[model samples]
Target: MFVLPDDDDRQFAVTLARGLEMLRCFLPGERMLANRDFVERTGLSKATVSRLAYTLTELGYLRHDVEARKYRLGGGVLSMGYPLLAGMRIRQIARPFMRELALQIRGAVSLGMRDGMNMVYIESCSADKRSDTRPDVGAVHPVLRLAMGRAWLAGVGPEEREVALNQLRVGVPDQWQRYRPQLDQAMRDFAELGACFSHGDMQKNIYGIAVPLSAPVDSETLVFNCAVMDHTPQARALLDDVAPRLIAMIANVESAAGLRQTVTTTPPRYPRR
Candidate 1:
């Protein structure tokens, strides 16, 4: 279910929010969904789901499957993201460095920004053979599950970090036990090294290391990550060596983008447990 402000909240548009919530029901690898799926996911009445689906289809935000009776996201969704992606100065400034890092590690490098409870990839550069789980622009992953997200959480202030972590715990209670220990360790690692690494935690055979980057031009916190598909010794060595390089690359990008003076120190003030 999606969260919505109370009716008393100012400037809240219920219909528009519900429409967007319906769109979010289509997750990664989910190509199509029927009206019933929306009803079930959103806990809305069948009539309401049908109406929302029809409205979205008419607006071109969703494409109706005439033969299969399903709906898929349409070009309209891309329209919403294009402006943001095109306007991101950090993506432009970091692209060349991301490409170089990918080529140097012969893997994938991505820049992502936090989106609600997930991290959304805004820019990605990949070597010839990319990891199976290597996400492209617009791909979303759980915030606490990926190295990029963990690094970002590490950079946030304590209160914000606690809020995000609490959201994760409440949203995915089943996985909290397994995630807590690793998250604690990542906090320590980031405190010491300014970066953190993950080995097949989010996806088996996918290894990654990430560092956070905060640019002066944008309020959003972004992270840079280098990833490899294999979990072999070679991949581990590459991850270990590339992490520091990734940090340096971010430093260079921040310097070029005039963000060095704005970057915050590590182990950002956290509330005592």
Candidate 2:
């Protein structure tokens, strides 16, 4: 039995929630899934999963593959994202600045927001003429492992950070162990420098530095990161020089957005057990 929220004013929509969950079952790099896959992922009955799959396919949210007997995300997902993407003022305001920063660092810069355990890229700029480092707008990186995520977590309230950490502890215990120490240090770095660095933490050869931004309008914690493919002397210089610039850029953004209040003090750090 599905448990509804305890709030009396909240109206629950079971079908809608299940449909969204079915959609979320498709992870990064998973191009296709069967009804059985949805059933396994969601713990829904096979019959219910089949019905939902058919309904979603008819609604243009899922594309059915007749030959492969699978379903992939359809164009309707783009429609769902377009309005949200279009309305993000930060992305619009940060574009030119990100472009300039990318060019200055001769690498890639991105603005990201936390989505569950992942940091979703909302906007990106690449200095490479070929745009080799540019990630897709909706690309996601693990929150505990990426520089942007660390910066974001560093800025969020203590309760929210604890909730997220608890979720990590329950969901991905091994990863939580691997990342706990680094995250603690990143929290300290963010407290001292207002920025966090990831030296080949996410990708083997890639290095990145990130700073959090205060988004008062929506109360969303956002982050900006500069990523380079390799840890060279140039990368080290960029990390040293660009991190301060990144913090200043975020301050400029907050000022432009009329978010006068800043999160100067770091949230209480989570202890490594």
Candidate 3:
């Protein structure tokens, strides 16, 4: 059940609401949007949007695209996120392995987790084709239409994955009910493969695979995944070589963390490579 909010909780909640609103203002697809698009997309007053945009751009969360007269993610944002992902060793342990996986597999390799209903990319190593539209760390992608999200969904138990699916309703913009059949198919497929994959789902011409992390974790512990693109039967082989390395990297991360069951009520965090 959702907790009833006290004053402190209420105030904190408000902060989160605004922060989220601000985040939605930045989309990787657009990366940079002009003021008009920003106001239209956000449905905020022009003045409010302008002020927030300016403040964020100045604060280094967003950058102004002078030529396009739009805004995009700034280096400052990466500066802040790098340490967090690095601290977790998820990227550290996974990077060398991912690059090796990408080299061996010759496709994109990514490590990701569910965060507040979206999949937050923690690490990525990719080939030229995958890099053409590569997802960056700190990029929050819809759990739907992505193999990385399915890996998380598939790795967990049925009851637990369902809870995550339910939570996805609130976290994702659209309702999950609409895609129940597809999700069910994915769940069944994951049960068989021990991993999940998708083609042209998150983006056209993109494909991937993923697995789980978090040993000694609870039923509710989030699923983690590694994904590789499928460009050819040759590239499809990347998943085979990459999967074992990803499994090993996850094991290394778990061993580093000592397999303790410390539930972080807050979301899991990862630092950069």
Candidate 4:
């Protein structure tokens, strides 16, 4: 579930919010869920979950499996996203660049935008066709720990970043404590190195470098990330080899998108081998 608006807000639609939150209970791997599962995941009463599930099923947002007595997301949910993705022109412009970088690094490149307190990948490219863990277009990741998220925070205005930080602090206190220092370092890196680096902070064997676009697209700040997954993580190689290329790739993307002439950043020179 995501952060709810203040209870006192007069125009907030409680039932609608609850219904949407129910949909969010479906994770990537878990496809089907019973009313009891919704109750446990959403903290809504069984009766409320039942009503919402039935309503959503009627609306075509969910499909009820009579035999399995479970619910799964329906075509309506996917249809809802098509317009949003289609409207994001930046994704089209960035895909070629992202694919090139992914192939060069033999890793994954993704473009994402903030969704509530998390970041959702709008586009992803991976060189490894057979890798099970390749980032997918709809995958969501926390904003506090990942390089893509940190770069976003680094690029945004201070007031916006502060508001997001306050939300994270209240919503996930443990994560705030564990990743705050790393986020601070990432901010410095963004200032000095033109990108933010995640040295296996997101996942045990994954390293990433990310940079935010110089300008927002359709008033939405977007971030691009390049991730390398390996059993033997190499932080220096990410900084010295991957970071420069990722920065340049973002610069080229920004230029192509006409967001700016080009990104102006003091990217570190690639280390001579």
| Superposition TM-score, candidate 3 onto the true structure | 0.67
Residue 37 C-alpha lDDT in model 4: 88
Q: Rate the local accuracy (lDDT) of all candidates.
A: 0.81, 0.80, 0.62, 0.84
| lDDT winner between candidates 3 and 4 | 4
Ranking the candidates on lDDT from highest down gives 4, 1, 2, 3
Model 3 weakest lDDT span, ten residues long: 264-273
Instruction: Report the C-alpha lDDT of model 2 over 1-273, residue by residue, as the tens digit.
Output: 222345763577878878888988888899999888898888888888899999999999999999999999999998999998898887888788788878877888898998877899999999885755677889988988898998888988899999888877876688789998889999998887777878767877777788887554476788899887775458765556677667666666676666765522222332221
Between candidates 2 and 4, which one is better according to TM-score? 4
- Per-residue lDDT of 6 in model 4: 62
Where model 3 places Cα greater than 4 Å from the true spot, the runs are 1-9, 13-16, 29-31, 34-36, 45-76, 127-134, 156-163, 170-179, 216-249, 252-257, 260-273
Off by over 4 Å in 4: 1-4, 230-238, 262-273
TM-score of each: 0.88, 0.86, 0.67, 0.89
Candidate 1 lDDT score at position 191: 88
User: Compared with the true structure, what per-residue lDDT tens digits does model 3 show for residues 46-99?
Assistant: 786778788888888888888888888777877886776666645565566557
For model 4, residues 63-123, the per-residue Cα lDDT tens digits are 9999999999999999999899999988999999888888877788899999866899999
- Give the best candidate by lDDT: 4
**Winner of 3 and 4 under TM-score:** 4
